[model samples]
Target chain A: GAGVSQSPSNKVTEKGKDVELRCDPISGHTALYWYRQRLGQGLEFLIYFQGNSAPDKSGLPSDRFSAERTGESVSTLTIQRTQQEDSAVYLCASSPRGGTGANSPLHFGNGTRLTVT
Target chain B: AQSVAQPEDQVNVAEGNPLTVKCTYSVSGNPYLFWYVQYPNRGLQFLLKYITGDNLVKGSYGFEAEFNKSQTSFHLKKPSALVSDSALYFCAVTSGNTPLVFGKGTRLSVIA
Candidate 1:
């Protein structure tokens, strides 16, 4: 794809339901990231995947928020037993190189807006 | 821990006038700073980055950012403003190989 792509641009789920968001990064990009954006807050880092290495789950807000990536391609973010506070935009970004180094800017997807009712 | 700050929640500028969006960051080691823009119903687009050397770095769409290590600031600037440039701007920072930490976005509104 010419740019990063995400599925179901908007989602509204009931509280306590599980929701999954998908992300397809640009071809050949080795690094991917997930972030959460609240109604009026900044983008909050959720998780990061670099190649086959263990993903950096340090940013996950809680155990309910989990993500998985296959190889260096598609990735999915799952929020189990979603709560009203989980309502936010889930963003996915990919870069040709890892987070470090110059000239490696992240290309982002339009993001999935998750709303918990 | 690494963090970035975009002080102004909104900035208003007239078309054809120079514009600036302020940013500041804090990190342990050498800071790698970045700027990104988000348009309505669109994803964030990378503007520029500052890694090392030349304090002034040029980026897409005729945008530029200056890295000030002493003040720990990386402010985005444009020689002229365009109404189309109105969007949400974000500043981010990363140290070593950590995930990028972003700041609360600043909304830029350029009046025609």
Candidate 2:
């Protein structure tokens, strides 16, 4: 894809139900990231993946939230049991490279608006 | 640790007036600063960044940001405001191998 792609632009689920959000990063991008944005709030980092190394799960809000990325391709964010507080827009972004000094600009997807009822 | 602060929740300006959005950051080492804009029902679009070199960095859509090391500020500026420029603006910062940290977004409304 020319840009980052996310599946199911919108999802509404009942409390306690599990939900999975998928992201397809841009081809050749080695770094992928997931973020959550609450209504009228700033983005909150959820997880990050760089190449084949272990993902950085430091930002995951709770154990119920986990993500997996296969190599440098598709990634999935799964919320074990949804709650009303879990309602937010889940965004995916990709960058060509990853590191501190790297000047890799992130390209974002349209994001999935998750609503937990 | 890295963090970003966008003090103002909203900014209003006339179409022809100049516009500015304030941002401040905290990082251990040299900071990588970025500005992104979000439109209604659309994804975030990159505006500009400051890594090194000149303090004044130019970016897309005739937008520019000044990296002030002393004040820990990277303020976004535009010569003239346009109605089309009205959107949600975000300031982000990162250092070393840490993940990007973003501040609460600021809403810019340019009245035409």
Candidate 3:
């Protein structure tokens, strides 16, 4: 609908396998973000795409985690060779502006619950 | 650099009683603070925000937050509690060009 949409509501993957999570941000939104939430924990910022600007990959845990956004449209987060520690809920959010607007609160998707075993 | 902290891991309140979830932040410049609630198996829902204007901001679901600059605090409050309010609440902050940093979240359980 109008809100951000994420695919594969739940995923179970064997260790050492690869998985790709998709996110469809709200139409016309300039900022798209990805975050990881561990069980009963807080959100860990993964990455964010603002328009055509180079995405901020500072929050990525390691080389195994990466993401891509196509012209502010759909985005994909790929975890290569996932490990048991990679299990968590991956959330996607979108906002009208990047990080400077007073009215740019993020709209989030239900998120993908990933299980690595 | 910007950061947020939710001191309490959980808060329990009786129905019809006032409730508060404490939050504190540290930012280099003016802080953009926000509150979000997460229900069971759901994504985070925006509650309210404090950007610049008023210190007290009203938001969805009969919730309000007070931004105290001097104290570096933005605490969420509600006059009366509802059992439906029992969920995980997260506090977040952003400053300048920094991405939003979230707190470890506080669970609010409103008993009936």
Candidate 4:
């Protein structure tokens, strides 16, 4: 319960449907991240939220992908009109904001395995 | 910009034998290297990290990684392999306040 937690550990949806994945980061952690891992591929950064500042959506592959973190607590990643290519394990990680001193590694959750059929 | 590379896609080692999983990095400044393992249908589990200090850093599950600045590598090592240790291993690197960049990952299969 102390580590990051993600909802809907496994999701199966029809293509072109919208889906939202939720992430509950560790309490007191200000930085939350989203990543996607396709079969046989590395984890790809999706979006990041650091405290109250604007989220960095540079890693988002397309406009259909977006995320929001409310008050440094919980975050949601939404994929609009998901395609088969969107099938992958969506991972969530959390860490303390800033450099690697007191805040070193990012703790990850079990992740949501999204399968778009 | 920072990047990590795991040259081998898979590693095979017999139980009780020493194991090495190679990892290389490309970063602008001092690299913050980390190793994580993933079991089937599971998230990445933290193994160990190299921030500064020592070149050889010990991590969880009897694993260690050697940070070689000159070679730009942070290869994971274990004195003795275990069958339970078989999993997908990833190497990650970060520079500045950027997000962690991960390698493709190497599947370690320890045979009994």
Identify the superior model by TM-score, candidate 2 or candidate 3. 2
Which tens-of-lDDT digit does each residue in A3-107 have in candidate 2? 899999999999999999999999998899999999989999999999988888998999999999999999999998899999999999998876431488788
Q: For every model shown, what is its TM-score relative to the native structure?
A: 0.97, 0.98, 0.97, 0.96
**Model 4 segments more than 4 A misplaced:** A99-103
Q: iRMS value of model 3?
A: 1.9
CAPRI-wise, candidate 1 is: medium
lDDT of 3 at A73: 95
Model 3 clash count equals 0
Worst 10 residues of 3 chain A by lDDT: A97-106
Better of 3 and 4 by lDDT: 3
For model 1, residues B4-108, the per-residue Cα lDDT tens digits are 989999999999999999999999988888999999988998889888899999999999999998899999999999999999999999886888899999999
Question: Please, what are the lDDT tens digits per residue for candidate 4 over residues B1-112?
Answer: 7788899999999999999999999999888889999987677888898888989999999999999999999999999999999999999998857888899999999999
Measured by TM-score, how close is model 2 to the native structure? 0.98
Clashing pairs counted in every model: 0, 1, 0, 0
Per-residue alpha-carbon lDDT of model 3 for A1-117, expressed as tens digits?
A: 578999999999999999999999999898999999999789999998898889989999999999999997999999999999999999999988554323688889999999999
Candidate 1: list runs displaced more than 4 Å: A100-103
Instruction: For residues A6-117, write the lDDT of model 1, one tens digit per residue.
Output: 9889999999999999999999999999999998899999999999999999999999999999999999999999999999999999988655423588989999999999
Per-residue CA lDDT of candidate 2, range B40-86, in tens? 77899989989889999999888999999999999999999999999
User: Relative to the unseen true structure, what is the C-alpha lDDT of residue A112 in candidate 4, on a scale of 0 to 100?
Assistant: 94
